[model samples]
Target chain A: MTTVPVRPPLVRSSDRIVAGVCAGLAEHLGWPVRMVRIGMAVASLAGGAGLVFYGWLWIMVPTADESAKRNARRPASPIAPAVSIAPSASMPPKHAAAVDPPLWTGAYSPGYPPGAVSTPPGGSAPAAGPGGYTPAAGPVPSVPYDAGAPSQPQEPSAVPSTGAWFRVRNMRYGKEILLGAGLLLVAAILIARLLGVEVPLGTLIPAAAILGGAAIAWMQLDETRRAGLVDKTKADQAGGWARLAAGLALVVAGVLVMVSGSGSWEQTWLALLASVAVLGGVALVLLPWGLKFWRDLETERAGRVRETERAEIAAHLHDSVLQTLALIQRRAANEHDVVRLARAQERELRGWLFRDPARDAGQLSDRIKAAAAEVEDGLGNAVDVVSVGDTAMTDRHEALVQASREAMLNASRHGGGPVSVYLEVSDGGAEVFVKDRGSGFELHAVPEDRMGVRESIIGRMKRHGGTAEINSSPDGTEVRLKLPAAAEDNGEGKS
Target chain B: MSTPALDGTAGDRGRTVRVVIVDDHAIFRSGLKTDLDPRIEVVGEAGTVERAIEVIGRTRPEVVLLDVHLPGGLGGGGREVIAGSAALRGTTKFLALSVSDAAEDVVAVIRAGARGYVTKTISGAEITDAVYRVAGGDAVFSPRLAGFVLDAFGTAPADIADDELDKLSARELEVMRLIARGYSYKEVAKELFISIKTVETHVSAVLRKLQLSSRHELTKWAAERRLL
Candidate 1:
C-alpha cells in the first residue's frame, strides 16, 4: 500500500563527505551540491548549528537503499512519519559520521547516482555553484531553509522556523544539542571578550559545570536505554566510553575553573565546596561500574538459590509422589480406574516437573494434546497425539484445532479402542491426520442427518479455505485436514 | 537381578528373548520387568547411564529397553549408553523407551543407534512385541515414531531418483503412514499386499536412512521441526 508518490523522495544520498545529509538535500531540491556542502560547512563552524541538522537528518531520513527497498515493498508516506517521535526523543545521537569514508565510497557507488557530478535541472552544476547559485535559490519553494540552510538568502523564512525546531527536538539529538549549545555559549563569550566586554568567570564556570554534568548524565541514560535494543559492537562501546570520559574530564575541568574563580570567597567555604565537587565527580565516575558489579553478584546468587530449590523439588518428587504412583500402578494392575488415575497423575507430575516456560500454553501441540486428553478421559480410549513443528495462533490454526478435536471425537465414538493424531507444520502448509483402527463406515452410506462429520470437520475446514478428506477402509478410518500457508491467505480476514 | 541364559536361545520362534531394561526410574524398571511376557525374560536392569553401559556390556542381552533421558555420564543419556556399548552393536539391539513427547530426544537416540522408539505409556503386550521384533533383527515403528520418521524424510522431493539414499521411497512412505495411522505390521502387510518381512525391510531401510545418511537437509529438517 502506498500514498501519492513523491517523484523523488528525500533520502540520504550515498555520495557524501560525512553522512550524506547535505548531498541528499541537494539532490531532492535540485540545488548545487557544492553550494549545499559549503553552506553546511559554514553553518557548522558558526557555533555547531550544522551538526544538529546533520544528526537530525541522519536519524530521520532513510538511506537511498533503504528507501528503494521500502518502496519496492510498501512505500512509506512522506507526509505522515512512519515512526512515532515520542520513543526516539529519548534516543542519544547516533555516531553516523563515524562511518568510514572508504567503505561508503566502495559500497554505494555501483547502484546510486553520482553525488557531485550530476547537474541540477536548472543547469547549475556543483562546479558552477560559486557563480550561479543565487538564481536557483529563489525559485525552489519546497526548500525547508532555516538556520540549517543559511546559504538560501532569498526566502530564508519561507518555512516556519518553529516547524524545523520541532522536527529537531523530535529527533532527540540529545548529545548534539548539548554540544551545540556549549559551542554557542563559547562563541558568545568569545565575541563579548573581543568587543572588550567584561565577562564574569563566576557565572561561566557554574554554567560549564551544569552543562558537563548534564552531558554525563545524558550519556549514562542513553547507555541504559540502548542496552536492551541491540548488542553494540566493540568499537561502538569503546567510543561511548570515550565520550563518557570526555564528559567526566569536562566536569573535572569545570571544578578546577570553579576553584580558581572563587578567590573572593571565605577559605573554609571554598574548601568545603571544592571537596564536595571532587567527591561528587568521583561518585559519578564510579557509579556505573559499581552498579554493574552489584547486579552481577545479585544474578549469580539468585541462580544458585534457584538451582538448590529445583534440586530439592526434584528429590522430593521422586521420593514421594513418583514412588506412590508406581506403587499404585503395581498394586492395582488389573483395576482400570486405579491404573488410569495413576497414569494421569504421573503425566501431570512429569509435566509440572519438566515444563519448558518458553513454550506458550496456546501452542498447536498443546491444544492438540489437550483435545486428545479430553477425548481419552471422556471415552476411555487412548488418544495419542504427536506433532512436529507448530504455527503461531491464528484463526485458521484455530479452525484446524477444532476440526482435529471433532475428528478425534468421531474416531473414539465410531472406531473402537485407540486413536492417533499426527500433526505436521511446514513452510508450505500444515496437515493433521486423525486415524482410528475399527470397521470403517462409508460416508455415502451414512444418513444425511448426521452433522458431525459433514459440518464440524469438513465444512469448518472448507470455511477456513482448507480441505478435509476422509479415507476409510475395513482396516481403519483416517481424517486428513490440510491448510495452506499463511502467506497465501493475505486477502482473507486475518482475525 | 540375575542374568538370563546367554546361550543363543533367544529367537523369533518358541525360544525366549533376553531383554535388559535400562530406565532412570527404578519403580518403572521393576514394573516393566514384571509386566514382560513369559517368552521374554528380563536379563539385566540399570538406573543410570554408566550403569546401563556396564550392565549391557556384561549381560549382552538380545534387546535393551533404553530410556531417552538418564542422570549420569555427561548428560548425553541414552545416546551415551549406546555409544559406550558400541562393541555389542552386532548382538544387542536398542529399543528406546521414553515418557516425554519431545521429538528431538527420540530422534537423537534413534540417530545414535536405537532400532526403535516407543513411549512408556504403551501396554505391556505392545512392549513385548516391540522387544521381540527388535530381537528378530527387525526395526520397530510405533505410531508416534512412524509419524516422526514421516515428518523427517517424507518432505523431500517427490522424485525418488534424485536423492534415493536420503529420501524415502513411495512404498516406504505409504508403509510409514499406515504405521502412523495405528496399523500393525501384519495389517500394513495385508493392506499393501506385501509380506510382514517386507514391511520390516521398509522400516529397517528408514531406520538406516535416519542414522547413516549424511544429508544436511535431513539434519536441518529434523532440528527445525522437532521441538526440544
Candidate 2:
C-alpha cells in the first residue's frame, strides 16, 4: 500500500454546523464526519461530557482561516516549498518504511503548509483524508497545493526529509513541543482522576513538579538563545535577567517538591538541607569559570587598545619618518641637503616622542621653545634652550617670550658662536637670559639704526612692565629679560 | 680665540691627555676625534656598553667621553658602563655626552658617577676643554646640566631640614646659576669675585653630594619635573 500522508492539524473547519467542531475532529482523525457527529450527540445526552469536550476544542483549536493568517505572519525560513518538499518526496522506499505509523497518523501535521487546509476545496470535504492527501496516480507535485498564497508557501512547510523520521524540521519549535507535552501530561492525569482512577499524589506531584520546572527552564533558555541571534538591547538584557530569576525560582520549587515527596518528615528536612548544600557546591565549582570569563574579556579589550595604538604609530611613521628617509636617499649626493633633512626629521621625531600630552600650548616654556626652534630653523644657528620652571601664559610672559625670540634672532645673526637661552620662573619674578658667544659689541656702539635689539627686545619688555638688560663685553652679549611677579598679576588682572 | 689659552695650558703640561670615546655612531666618534685639539690623544673607541667597559678597563684612559645613550649590555646604557667600570672609578672619569637634554637622563648618569654631562652639540674646542677638565678632577657642567642642577636643588622644600646634605650650598647655587647663564667657570669666578679654584671646589662638592646622597626626595623631584 502507498504510504498515507500525515494527519492535519486540529483546527475548526470552514464547513460548519454548530461551530464545525465535529467536522474538524473528523478531518483531523481521518474518520467519517457523520460518525463523529453521532458520537458527540450520544455523549452529550449521557452526561454532558460532549459539551465540555466541544468547548475545550473550540477554545484550543483555531479556525482554519485564523491559523492560515497566523501562518502568513510567521517569520519562517524563506526556502521555497519545491526545494524543501522535493527531497522528502524522493525518499527511498526503505527509509519511508522506517517511519512510525502511529506518529504519521497523529492529529498534528506541523510540516504541511497551513494553506493546505484553508483552501475551499479541502475545507469542505472531511473525507479528503488528512488534508495532505494528493492522489498517487501521478508523480507528487513539488509545488505546494495552495500556490496562490505567496506568503504561506514556506510558512508551515518545515518538513524534515522523509528519509530521517526523527529529525526535527525547525529548532524554533522546541519550546512549543515542550509546552505541548506538559499540557498533554496534565490532561492525561486529570482525565484519569475523572474516570475514578486512584492516581498517587506522591508520584503525581513530584512528576508534575519536575516536568513543569523543566518546561519553564527550557522555554526561558530557548528564548535567551533566540535573543542572542539578534542584537541585544537594554530591554533584552532586562528580560534575560528576569528569565534567570524565573529559572532559579523553578529550580528551588523543584527541590522543595522533591524534599516534601520523600518518605518521612526527618527525611524531608534532610533532603532539603542536602539540596541547599548541593546548590552551594555547584556555585563554588562554577566560580573559577566566571572569573576566567571576566579576565578574558578584559584581556581582549586591552588587546584591542594595543592594536589601535600600534596602528596609529605605524601610520605616523609612514607619513613622516619614512617619507623623509626617502627624500634623503634621493638627495644623498647633496651633503648639506641630507644633513638638513636628517636634522629636521630628528627634531620632528623627538618632539613627537617626548610630547607631554598634559601640557597646553600656551605655557611659557612651550612658547619659548617654539621661539627658539623657529630661530634655529631660520638662521641655521643652533640655539640651546633650557627652561627650569613654567608659569601660566600672561601678557608679561608673552612679552618675555617675544623679547627672548628677538634676542635669539639677533644673537644667531651676529654672534659668531652657539647661543643659549635660560628661563627660570620663581615666586619673585620670571627671568629669561639669552646669551650668545658672539664677539660683544657695545650697547652704545650699536648704531641707533639697528632697531631689532633696542626696539623689539628692550621696547617690548618695557611696554609689558618688564626690564631688559643688555650686557655686552668682549666675551659675548647677554640679553636679560625680567618680569616681576606683581607685573604678572597685573597683566592677569588687566586681561 | 679661547683655543690659544686652552692650547697654552695643555702645552705647559707638555703631554697630551689620554682619552677613550664611547658612542654608538661611528661617524660621530671619528668626527669628534678629528675636531679635538691635538693636545688630547684618542687611546681607544667603543660602540656599546660592554665594549666600553672592557676598553676603559684595559686602556686605563685618563678620561672617557661616554655617550649617555648606547646600545647593548643592560639597557642602562652609559650608567651601566660606569657601574661596570667601578674598579677604575678613580683613574677613569666619565663625561656623559648626549643629543638630548632630558633632565632624568642627565640626572641618572650623574648619579651613576659621571663627572659631567654635555649635549652632543658642544663645539669640538669645548669638548676638548671638558675632557681636559674632567681629567683634571673637575666636574664639567654644560649650561643645560647646570640649569637642571639648579632647578633640582635650588628650590628647597620648607619641610626638609636646613642641613640636608642634598641641599646645595649658597656658593654652589651661585655657581650653578652663573653656569646656567652660559658663563664659563673663569667668568663665574670673575663675576662672583672668587678664584677659579673656589668655583671648581664648589662644583666638585655639589657633584659629590649628588652622587653620595641617598635621598629619595631628590630623585622624586627630578622625576616629577621631567622636561617632556
Candidate 3:
C-alpha cells in the first residue's frame, strides 16, 4: 500500500469512463491505459460488481489536474511545501487556467503528455507551456525569480538516492496500471472456474498475447494527440453514459455465457461469491484515497467561494451606498438637518455591519465601540468606549447593542462634549453604562413624539428581558442597562 | 467661496468696514455676505480655523465672520483661531456666526471674546447690523444668545473665579482687552500713548501671570473668564 500524501491524491484531468478514476490510477501507477480498461471490462462481465466498483471510484477520485488547480488556488497546504517550490502552487492567477478551467475537465479531456512527470505535483502550471519538460534542476526554478529558495535548505533533503529516485519517478505512471490489470485477470479466471465455465488453462497464453498486442497498439500513446484518438472511441458519450453502455454490454455478454452453460443456480451463486470477494478486495485498497480526495476538494473550494462573496459585497457597499449617503447629507437643508441625516445613515450602516454573520458574535466591547463611533462621527461628539468585564456579551448581543446605540445618540443630543461608554460583566450578564456631563432631562418631561429614550432605549431593553435605569442631575446623566445572558435566562426558566 | 470685497459698501460714516468671512460653509458664508449692509466690505473668506488666522493677519479687517466651530489649526474650533492670531488684535475683531445656539456654544465663543454670537437663522439684514455694531466696538448677540452670555458671564463676576483676573494690574487689564480684541501691539501703544516696549512688557507680564502660552491662549484665557 502506498502511503498517501497528507493532501488529497492527484487525479488525472483527461481520459476516463466516468470520474477519471482509472485515468487517475494510471497516472499514479504509470501503467498503460489499455491494461486498466481491459481489466475493468473483464471484471464487469463476471457480474455487476465491477460496474458498481467503477461507479464508486468515479465519485471518490479527484482527477490530478483538478487537485492541482485546487492546490494552486489554496494558499497553504502541508504536503505542498515538502514536495517542491510550493509557493507557485498557491498562485491561482498564474496556473488556474493553464491547469484546467473546469472541475470536471479531466473526465473528458486527455491526461497530459507521456511527459507528465514534468508537470508540477500541483498540476495546473502553464509549464504545460513547454511540453511539460522537467529541465535539469527543474523544481528549484518553478517560480522564475526564485524568491524563497535562498532562505531554506528544503530541496536536496527531499530527493532520494539517485538510482531509487529515477526508478520510481521516471517509471512515468505504468507500474500500478499493469499490476491492477494482472489482478483483474486472476479474478476473471477465478470467476470462470466458479461458473463451471470450462477453464482453458492453456488459453491463458493466448490471452497474454492478445493483451500485449492491444497494449502495444494503443498503450504507447500517452500525450493528448493519441489520447484524443482513444477518446474518439468514446464517441460523443460522456464518461458516465459510456460506463452505462459498457456495463450493460458486459452484463448481456455474461448472460449469454451463462445460458450457453449448465445454467444452474449453484454456478450463479458461485459467480456472485467470487465477484464479491474480488471487488471487495479492490475497494478495500482504493476507497480510502477516494474519500480523502473528496474531502480535500470540498474544503478548499468552499472556503474560496465564501471569501470571494465577502470581498464582492464590501466593494459594492463602499462604492455605491456609502458615497450616495455622503452626498445627500452634504446637500441637506441646514446643519441640523445634515446632522440628522448623517446620524440615521450611520445607524443603518452600523446595524448592517453588526448584523453581518462575520462579526456578529465578536466581542461585545467592539460592538459597543462601533455604536459609539457612529454617534461620534454623526454628531461630532467625543466618545470613549471602555470595557472591563472578562465575560463575552453572551445572548443579548443585538438587543444590548441597539439599546446602547440609542443611549449614545441621546448623549450626543442632550449631553455635553465628551461621551463615555462602559461595558461591565457583573452578575450573570453585562451592564452597559453611557455617561455624559450635562444637564439631565426630566423623564416625565420628555414629549410623546421623542422615541430615542422611549422606544429605542427603554422599549428595546424590555423586549430583551433587560432593565434600563436613567438618573439625571445638574452635573450629568447616566443611563445604565442590565442585560442577562441567554444561558442564564434559560437556567432560570427551567427552575 | 466668494471673494469678499476689501472695501466696505460706502456708508454715511465714510469708512469701508473691511471684513473677512471665516465660516466653514461656503454657501452660507456667501449667502450671509449677500445680505450684509452695503457699508460692510467682505474682505476675504477662510474655511478653517488656521486659514482664518492667516487670512485675518494679512487683511487686518475691522470685523471677521468667524464660525463658532471650525477645523484645522487646533481642536478648540473658533476659540483656538482667536487665540492663535494675537498680532491682529486692535486692527480687527472677530464675531462668531454659527449654526449652534446652545448655551455652551454661545458662552464658549463669547469667552473666546467673539464680539457677538448669532445664529445662521438670522436674516441677512440682521447679521449686517450685528456686524456693524461689532465693528463699532459694541458686543452684539442674537437676543437669545445674549441671554445665554449674560446668564453665564455678564451678570456677575461674583460667581466667577478671580484668581487669574487678580494677576492683572489695571493697565495690564486694559492692554489685555486690547490684545484679546485683536489689536496689534503698535495700535495698543498708540492708544495708550505708551512706548511699544512698555506695551510688550505689559502683555508678556499678563501672559505670565495668567499662566498662558501666547497671545492666542491669552485671548482664550481672557474670553473664557469674561474679563474682556
Candidate 4:
C-alpha cells in the first residue's frame, strides 16, 4: 500500500490571524502555504462565516500537543533503532544545550516538564536535580491492540507507541533550515514595512523558507544513514568531506545573499554584516576536526583486520598441520617407527620455515604452551614442563629438540594427569624426560603408538646413537631420551 | 625396452643405476635427489600423485622409485602403485621412496603393492642400490619397515597336525614314511612288506596301534614329511 504523507500539525502565527488551519492544510498538501493563507483570508472577508469553520476545524484536528500520546499507543516492530537516552538535569546546562541546537530563541523549548517523572535512576539511591524535589514515578500507560487500523498514543509512559515518534528527530536538519528561513523572511518583510521600501520579493520569502528547509533536512538524513554503514575509518573520511562541502557552500551562499540584498554598500548594517562572516569562519574551523576523526577511524579498522587474520592462522594450524601429525603417531605401532615418522613430519615443517605454508607459525608457540598448560589446567596445577633443555638448541639440532617437544606436546594433550618435563645436560649429552603422574600405559601388553613417542624419542635418538627409554606401569609413565654427547655438545642453536 | 647398461657417467666412478625419483615435496625431493652419485643416473622426477604415475609410465627406468604420500589424496601414491600392478606386472619394480618410516605407512604402501620401502634420508649410494635391487625384483625395505612386513606375514596360523598319527613311536613314524613311499601289500609279503600272513598282521597292528582309524592320516603324515 502506498503511504499517505503525514505532516506535523501547524501552529498559528501572531501577525496573521491566530487560526492555523491554512498552515496545516498547506503542510499536508505540499502547496505554497502563503497561497493557502491568502485564499483563506479572501474567503473570510467575502463570507464572514468562514471564521466559524476555522474554529471548528482547529478544535477537531490534532496538534503537536497530542504527539506524545499518539506515540505511546503504537505497536513496536522487533527491529528498530535504539532509542537515544536524553541527559539528566545534573549535567551542566551548557553541556546539555550543546547536544541539540535550538530552532529559535523564542517559540518552542523542547524539554522535560519540571514535574515530569523519570525512570528510576539506574543505581541504588535517587539523586536530586536542580529543583531538589523528590521525583515522582510516572504511571506506565497501557495500549490497546487493534485488529484493523493501528492508531497509537504518544507518551514516554506508553510502551507501544515509541517507534512512531522515534523518527521525528530524524528531520531535525529540516527544522533548523525552516526556522532560519522563516526568521529571514519575517526580517525582510519587517524591514520593507519599516523603511517604506518597495521590496518586490517580500511576498515569496515565507514560501521559500519552508520549502528549502524540508528539502535540506531530507537530504541530510539520507547521507548520514548511508555513511553509518561503512567501516569507521571510511565513514569518518566521508563525513569530513561532507562537512567541508557544506561549509563552503553555506559561506558562499550567505555572502552572496547579503551582498545582493543591500541596495548600496554604504547602507549595510555592520552588525548583521559581521554575523555572516562569523558563520563562514565557523565552517572553516571544523575542517581539521573532521580530518582527525577520519584518521582515528582508519587506525581502528586496521586493528580489527589484524585480529581476524591472526585467528584464521590459529585455526588453520590446529585443524590441519597438528592434527595430521597426531594421526600418524596414533596409527604407528612401533616406537622406533613412530619416532621416524615424527622426525619426518618435523623436518617437513622446518623446511617451510620462511613461508610457513601451514600458516600456524604465529600460533605454534601458543599451541605448544597450551598443550603443556592442558596438563596443569586439567590436573589443577599439579604439573608443568620445566624447560626444553635450556632452550639452547641450534637449527641443525632442532630435529632432536623437536622430538622432545612432540613428546611433551602429546603427553600434555592426551591422558589426564599431572605432567612435568625434566631436562638434564652434561658433557655426555642431554636427557629430557616427560613424566606424568597419572596411571601409565600397560606396556608390552597393549602397545600405544603415540606419535610423540615415535617422532620425538625414537626419531631424534636413532640419528645420533642416542636412545629413548620408556618405563611405564600402573603407576605412571616416564619417557626419557638420552642424546649423543657429540651431537648435543656440537648442536647449533636455532637462529 | 631396457636402458643401456649404465657403465659410467661424466664423473665416472662405477656402473651407474638408472633411477626415477618420485616424491610429493619439492624441497624434500630436491634434498634427497642431490644424494644421487656419479654411480647413479637420475633419469626422471615427479612430484605429485598424477605426475608420478605419468612420469613412471613413460620412463619405465630400471627402478620407479616412489613416495607413499602424494597431493591428489592421502596415499594416492600407494594406490597409483598398487593399481598399476596389473600393467606394471613385471615391466618396472616400485621402490617406495619416503621421508616417513611409520609402520602403517610402510606396510600400507607395501600392501598397495610396493616392491620396497626406503626413507628419503638414505645416502646416495644406498639409494642407488635400492633402485637397482627393486628393479631386479628383490624386495628392499628400510630395516625397521622390513621387520614390520615380516611380522605381518609371520603371524599367520599354521595348519593343524593329527595328534593320533603323530603319537606314533619313532620306529613307527619311520616305517610309516617308508610304507607311504610306495611299498605295496604284495611287496610287503616279500621283503619289508613282511611274511605272507605276517604282513597282514603287521599292517592291521600298525593301523590299530596308531588309532588312525583310516589310511588318509597316514598318507597326509607321510606327505608332510615330503616322503611321497
**Cα miss at A401, model 3 (Å)?**
2.9
TM-score of chain A of 2: 0.43
> What fnat does each of the candidate structures reach?
0.31, 0.54, 0.00, 0.00
Name the candidate, 2 or 4, with the larger lDDT value. Answer: 2
Docking class of 2: acceptable
Model 1 ranges with Cα > 4 A deviation: A1-200, A207-247, A261-370, A373-380, A388-398, A424-430, A438-447, A462-467, A471-476, A482-495, B1-13, B157-163, B216-228
**Stretches of model 4 off by over 4 angstroms after superposition:** A1-495, B1-14, B73-75, B101-103, B150-228
DockQ of candidates 1 onward, in order? Answer: 0.16, 0.28, 0.01, 0.01
Q: Rank the candidates by TM-score, best first.
A: 1, 2, 3, 4
Candidate 2 positional error at B167, Å = 2.1
lDDT tens per residue, model 1, A1-495: 000111235688999778888888876655668977988889899899878877877897889999778656633233222111111222111211111122223333232343322211111111122322244344433222222222322222212223333443434344455566778888998999999999996868766775776668576767758675355689977887877777766775566557656564475466667777988999999999999999997798679879989999889788768776777767685676665566556656656655667676788778887888888777767777767667777788888899999999999999986787878777888888898878998999977788999999998888887899999998679899998886445665343
Error of 1 at A232 (Å): 11
Task: State candidate 2's TM-score.
Answer: 0.58
Give the Å error, residue A445, model 2.
Answer: 4.5
lDDT of 4: 0.47
lDDT of 3 by residue, A132-187 (tens): 23333345434423333333222222211222233434343355556666888889
lDDT of each: 0.70, 0.72, 0.57, 0.47
The numbered model that scores best in DockQ is 2
Candidate 3 local distance difference test against the native: 0.57
lDDT of 4 by residue, A306-347 (tens): 987889877766765797578776867765445445544453
lDDT of 2 at A467: 89
Tell how far residue A139 is off in model 2, in angstroms.
Answer: 64
lDDT of 2 by residue, A360-381 (tens): 7678988998898888778767
- Candidates in order: C-alpha RMSD to true structure: 16.3, 18.6, 26.8, 27.7
